[model samples]
Target: MRNDIQIDKRSIGINFIDGKASVRIWSPDSKSLEVKLENKSIPLTKDDFGFWTITTTNIQPGDLYKLVINNEQEFPDPASVSQPEGVHGRSAAVDVSSFNWTDQSWNNLPLADYILYELHTGTFTPEGTFEAMVSKLDYLKELGVNAIEIMPVAQFPGSRNWGYDGVFPFAVQDSYGGPEGLKKLVDACHAKGIAVVLDVVYNHMGPEGNYLGAFGPYFTSKYNTPWGNAINFDDAHCDGVRSYFIENVLMWFRDFHIDALRMDAVHAIKDFSPVHILREIKLHVNELSQHTGRQHHLIVELDLNDTRFINPLEEQGFGMDGQWIDEFHHALRVTATGESTGYYSDFSGIADLAKSYKDAYVFDGQYSHHRQKFFGIKAEKNPGQQFVVFSQNHDQVGNRMLGERTSELVSYEMQKLLAGAVLASPYLPMLFMGEEYSEPNRFMYFVSHTDKELAEAVRKGRKEEFAAFHAEGEAPDPVSEETFNNSKLQWNLVKEGQHKTMFNFYQQLIQLRKEQPALKHLNRQHLKVSFDEAAKTLLLHRWHEDQHVVCLMNFSQQEQKIQAPTEASNWRKLLASHEPQWLGKTEAPETFEAGEEILLQPESIVIYQNS
Candidate 1:
């Protein structure tokens, strides 16, 4: 009954106590349940809480076992913390308390001060292991990134996956060095003064190795998700289902020492309970944070522009810290590349980008051509840190026909322009892995499913999806090992010519964002954005206290001439992408005169501080 691991306080998973192991399984629908371990079968007793339990002195850590339902149907533990072999293998007992952690003095940074760098464990490095990433902590720190949002590490079908296909939510991927490897990475990151954000999927389970239905009604038939049946959060016997995922959230924060959880596609999580599941998670996370005396945050990936998610709980909302704003990326991409195929059709260029700067949502209450309906609610009341902005992310790149990154879609100057726009905004900025140096490799969607039929179907689905973009030629095989190899980041490019320059440009921009008074504080109320449609110029003016900063951006391929933003012009140039040091083709004066016509180089950005 003692809370050894704060998450294990529920007493659902197998726990070791006083030289004995206690096993518990929640199978409300099962008439009988027993443990099948080694060569023996141990029967379990059912309780009023609908969980079958047993205690045996013979069990030990590292032992693999499965639950036998009604003495016939056998499946891995639903609350397994270690799936050693794979998702289909038996669950192994893991003693998380055995690891000695030295992060006692470490705590997470405030959400407003975060500069996030998102990376996939498999593709971020060649070794593709959590332990392998320890070597790059200093590199990220040097790049001015204080937090890293890692893609999912749950136990999936095979060694190669996007992690959304994970079946065991509690277990870390065996190919990624498992739980111990993850702990070491977190500990090292904390030592380097970097926070860790983990991506989690609760919408639906993967097709293969998913056996939750055999135990109980973990899913509901009333509503559906993009994957299939939705989680049973509001249906019959939903308390157990809610507890299952809430405990998972606590497990990551308490056991792994993760600072935040990036919930994947929260719009897909169909829940209609009296109190939403997200609110429950927020309540529990707040409790855990209070108990541990560490700051923890919940960030959601929501398609809708609803501000209710980030609104405080007392205001009858979910109270999430932030959500990813895809509209900003869409507008910036359309402006940079002139690509308006699928969803990009909804956004108009610099205007939306400017709107996203002042207001968090560009499509707020506007009719979306792609959806053929009025979408989004205005979120201007929310603070800047309530939204996260990026020019390139996993969905923006991998969902493409060729998986081409933003760097591949536009010229070098345009890439710099996009980075400047994202960093200058009132919201928090994020950079996809390999984006700082503009790595040439692609981030295609690749998978390795054990089921041959399912694998083939995935390839077909990918091809059909590409039809929306009207891409020519066949897509590279997603199931091919070669595809996974092609997606890995080219780390060597960092030391190369133009790539190295791009890295410095990003580093300077981030450093200015943190050090400058106007840019450091994420205050939406003290910013103004306006765009000239004819000249393809956007002006962003931000101020905090008395420090004023002006960003002049030219999005056109041709050079633009714009009037000065202020009549009194004694501005200090903080950064100019057209400078020779930034590998630019043109140069401009360091200070601007009053009523002067400033010439902006094609596809370049210039930041000036009012002197």
Candidate 2:
């Protein structure tokens, strides 16, 4: 036996027998650590590193076990991979190698051509299980989505949740059909040529049923988050805590065969170390990717407008593949919906949209009335592909007073314009599930907690949080079964006339993106945007070599026109919101021709290619 390896202090019993199951746990603070299996207690033999081990013939895969620490408090294994019931229940032993994977020849889809679809697993379907979601693979594939970004599936203290309240970082949620179920889903998706990106929350665990502190100093009270104490990533004994999370990231890719991971609210991770946790995670994931011959990606949900997240460290950057650019979404939303409240207050007219499109940041060192301080860095030189743009996402939709979508707030014509702006942009595009079909149902926040007191608090807090919006009626109790049912996608909506039209339009837009080289190029400096601020219209020109594509958007509700600039003469209408009507207006209007109008329908967007 190699005595140089340091054993984990929380391990109970670890025996590396040829056929028998072995378990190990380290409890240096505890006088005794016993493994309880099938109503029998087996005392573990303590080793040098506070580890206790036992090789048991009866212990096998699918067995339920718990560790009695200090002979007083019983807890699940801290390194457990499957919590079959809930975070508070016994950990289920699972043999990852036992599950037969069928995606042997699966290769990850290239990130450059990705159109990510983000979905919440709990309310994505009626059954809300991983097995049940297999039926929807065809639907997503048909929608032209190359990747699926699933919301967090880590074990929390409930049977149903939005997944932000996850406690068990390593274990897959039992309510979502456990570890085997998720593996099956990933394998199925790979076979269908779809990549899977898991959304992980490492900022802080849920309020209840979290036992990380009992084993070691995994949290620190030095800083306070909206939830509570921040994770102890930069404090004493922090290396072990960091290693614990990094290992979890590796486990997902190596065992589950996940293509990528989306780190949730990375700005909240609050690390100030020499080698940041994110950088360390990137290094390990990259190493694993090379060893396994699989492409692994890390996407961060960063609220800060920092370019360092995507820029290379040689250039003094954080080295993330990409980060969610809310500025683009906010700018698009303001132009589409004309709503200016909360964060949307800073976003107003075409100026913000033009700025966001040309340079991925609207608040680039500009004075912000919202933050009462200068915010964001200038990203004028960065490649657009390093940012992910969206019109609607889980945060924008679910955080609403009633979880209403853009379809509910804006006109159909405006939605098409929003679609044009997102699809035609150089940045990678993402869609919330059912957004393409303009589905009427909303995705409300829902959860089912085992503790009644915590459930009541969640319900009350949800209602009070929307008090400023003056929303009608009390907020729906998230714990109610009705909330979950109401959030499900209505498939019948796709067959309806207007919804079907919108869906086809989205499909065409996606196809256009894939077919055009100018649309895929991530270069930002080569693109130029001009807007007639007074007329509520804008023209975006993207050029590579001698080829160029021009996109025009009309933000006004009423029909209006503007004299075309000199470059417009070379333009030909390739795609339009109201196509077949504006086919051949190739000749550019006189540059100095004032009051010379091009007819535009209310809230219509048009795209023109240089022929």
Candidate 3:
């Protein structure tokens, strides 16, 4: 039982211990398993737990090998840490302990201090490598985000991928500089006082070059996922499958020193075991922390607003440290852009936005017209920092037919308002790549699959998804090089007009979110959110101890009237979108007192703090 189990560090795949190479694999479905090195194959002894193990000095680092199943078919190790020749090629032996890390005194920041900037490695820069991203860390530090959330880096087919199609769970994307590149990047980030958060897809492996099924029952046929077969977590022989993924989780924290992991699409993870796989992962993380004496976090990206994922393990929940809330983004987007299509149609603008500010889940136990059912449950029991809110993310933008970013879809002033709404919330705020500078680049979905049929299927799926969102024109070819190239961010835009202003505005907002007493602490209980539907305005008031701050936002195209909170007097202006520096059309005063009527500029936000 997990209650009595005191987990310790367990090594999977290839490892070097006591001056010898030890190879381990779990394959119950195979009658015979052999480790095929250059020009030779060695048999491995299988134990009762269905894991094949061998310790020998013959296999060493830098040697390429494959696992021979049933003395015929060959495939890479399921937990290969190095895939030098893409997903279909042989797995290279990697000495995991070789990387020299310098940040020995590095410690993680409090979760409330995390202002995450989510970026895709392939599209973040022109060079599109971990080394290139390292050069931009200083720029990110200046932007005031304390952490960066990198998209999935697990090895995938070919060169280009959103990374959801990864086949090797333990391997770093070779195209993105492999394991060595990632280590350098993480080390550099720690030196800059920045935390690294990696996005990992655990629900399903990509279809192309996926050979895990050949060795063992890694996937189950009883259940289906939107992408492919659901992972075999709760079905027969589930213990091995659970260990496969749980070990993957430990590999990142123990070997790579990743500060946090964002588990992608947990809603699709079909697990019905007595002890859920996610909970087990959390328990293992705790044990790993104890062994390593370091703090690690597991933040899940789930569409379901169930607090069970964030609830404590003692309370019969999965005990994830944090979760991304999309309803907050949907509400703020619908309010600012007036986009009432698809899921946006369900949100009633300011009312839903206000609800999200207070409860984090807007559709809690309410009927959702889009999903066509009662969606979510109340998450008020969870603290504010446990919820991460974002206005633009990879999926929220890239999945579109044209893949237009929020900058292309909304006005300049409205973008400022959206940024304010996210930062002002009591939850941790995340910004999509290039959003800080309002970079005008389409983050289209692209993948370079060796399988022609799979590429065509992806194109068809993208077209159908676009149609569902009522998009016009032909969808961009998902497998085309043009599609991938066009998605690259234009770094030159940061030196230009409104983009520069937007970047400065974001820096101020992020700085204020860190320095302001009321905004710095994420206390949902001390926050009061209210909105006027007729005026299309929302007022958010937050108080921490003796400090009080209020943010008034006008989402309408025309100027709207708003009133300050009655209790707080001598309110001084800290930041406002209506300020001339922020490029607002209408000029506004610097300060407003309690119960004062203020005419806010169209599509703007003003934050006032009591002196």
> Candidate 2 lDDT, tens digit per residue, 1-611?
12222222212223224566677654545678787877788887777655567777767788888888778888887777788767788888766545688998997887777889998887777788899888899988887888999999988877778899888887888888888999999999999999999999989888778887786678888888877899988987676577678777877788798998899989999789888888877777777777778888888998888887777756767778888889889888877777787778888768898998888888889899988889989875567767889999998998886788888988777888888889888888999988898888988888878789988998888887776556677677788888878998887888688888888888878887877777767678778888877778887778666667777788887767755445534556567785532222233332222223566666777666666
Instruction: Estimate the Cα RMSD of every predicted model relative to the unseen true structure.
Output: 1.9, 4.0, 1.5
lDDT of each: 0.89, 0.78, 0.89
Off by over 4 Å in 3: 1-10
Off by over 4 Å in 1: 1-10
The 10-residue segment of model 1 with minimum total lDDT is 1-10
- Model 2's C-alpha root-mean-square deviation from the true structure amounts to 4.0
Candidate 3 clashing pairs, residues 3+ apart or interchain: none
TM-score head-to-head 2 vs 3, winner: 3
Error in Å for residue 139 of model 2: 1.8
Model 2 clashing-pair count: 12
For each candidate, what TM-score against the reference?
Answer: 0.98, 0.91, 0.98
Checking candidate 1 for backbone clashes, the offending pairs are none
Query: Candidate 1, TM-score vs. the true structure?
Result: 0.98
- Estimate the overall C-alpha local distance difference test score of candidate 3: 0.89
Deviating ranges (above 4 Å) for candidate 2: 1-28, 42-58, 467-473, 563-569, 579-597
Ranked by lDDT, the better of candidates 1 and 2 is 1
What is the Å distance of residue 583 in model 1 from its true position?
A: 1.1
lDDT of 3 by residue, 402-482 (tens): 889989999888899999999998999999999999988899999999888888888888878766678889988889999
